[model samples]
Target: MDSFVNFFKKIPNKFASSAKELGKVQGIAIIAMLLALRVVLGMFANIGLAFNPYVKIGFTFLPMALVAYYFGPVCSMITACLGDVLSYVFAPAGASFTPGITAGYIIEACLLGIILYKEKISLPRTIICEVLVTLIGSLAINTYFIYMFYGLTYLQLLGLRAATLIPWAIIEGILVAVVVKALNRVPAISKNLPTT
Candidate 1:
């Protein structure tokens, strides 16, 4: 029993010593998975629900910010922005101005990436930060660019109602928190992130 406990205690410190660290690879894989998920989800949403065009399932930035939370903003921010660009090229969901919305998406991702890059990755902190990012980002920061580029009012563009959108935002936050938690159980995945 003593030996078993000792061995388990030593496990984490083994991977915590590397300079490049674990989150880099984990960041790579997670970003790739996010891109793939976005593409597949977009395709399904397009086919399955005609009227659900503007409805977004945004787990991308949450994970990106998580990566940034450990890996630094520049690395994770680029990881995120590139993921969005790739998603657009691969999926092509909207007919609106690509450059503009892409810019907004990247901006939004980077902002949270900047903020959470300094914080812990626990659920309570993360969910609140995530919702704040979406509200300030999606509603305030990007609203004007979205309106100008897409030629729709703020309400029309995002389908923004505090009631409707908050639920979705909360759902996205929970989904990201749960998915990251599950990913942490996989040694290969958790092995890549920075130290606790």
Candidate 2:
């Protein structure tokens, strides 16, 4: 479909914009701060759920989401990759390394950046973006990786994921909407906002 093609086309544009933005020292500093925040948040905020072996309720995504919004796809993706890698190293969430899950993080960050960067903050868009990321990254891709790394079957993992991530996605959508709207009040974060 034309929409699908256009969507792919937009990815490169977002990456190019991200690279350009990161060329600035301010941009690099912002990304480093976000990455460090993500790791710290990851270290402290994650609460492993007793109901699921792999599920954890965490607030680390907040910084990564901000990175996606304030920076661009490239920065968001890089931050996500490093943030996750370092978090696992420092925090040790009790899971072994699975590259597929790491890939999911990068995809999730880039997807959010692409959907949200330079766009107006809105409830509908926030919900849509969060749900898409949850479905694709958290549910599908992550479930696959979890199954590969752990012992759960795909169906079992999918069921467990649906139980946790659906509600988490709703909460994440509202949180992102609120935070982004508030951040837009700052001239720095709002600098990238598309002008009417």
TM-scores vs. true structure, each candidate: 0.65, 0.88
Global CA lDDT computed for model 1: 0.57
lDDT of 1 by residue, 6-120 (tens): 6456434432322243346665665566556554544444332245444454445554655555554455546556666766677666574356556665566655555445344
lDDT tens per residue, model 2, 1-196: 9977876777778778878877788778878987999999889988888887678888877888888877778888999999989998997865576778899999999898998776667888888888899899888888897777667789988998789988898899889889978877889766744331
Tell me how many clashing residue pairs each candidate has: 4, 0
Q: Cα lDDT of all candidates, in order? A: 0.57, 0.83
lDDT of 2: 0.83
Which candidate has the highest TM-score of all? Answer: 2
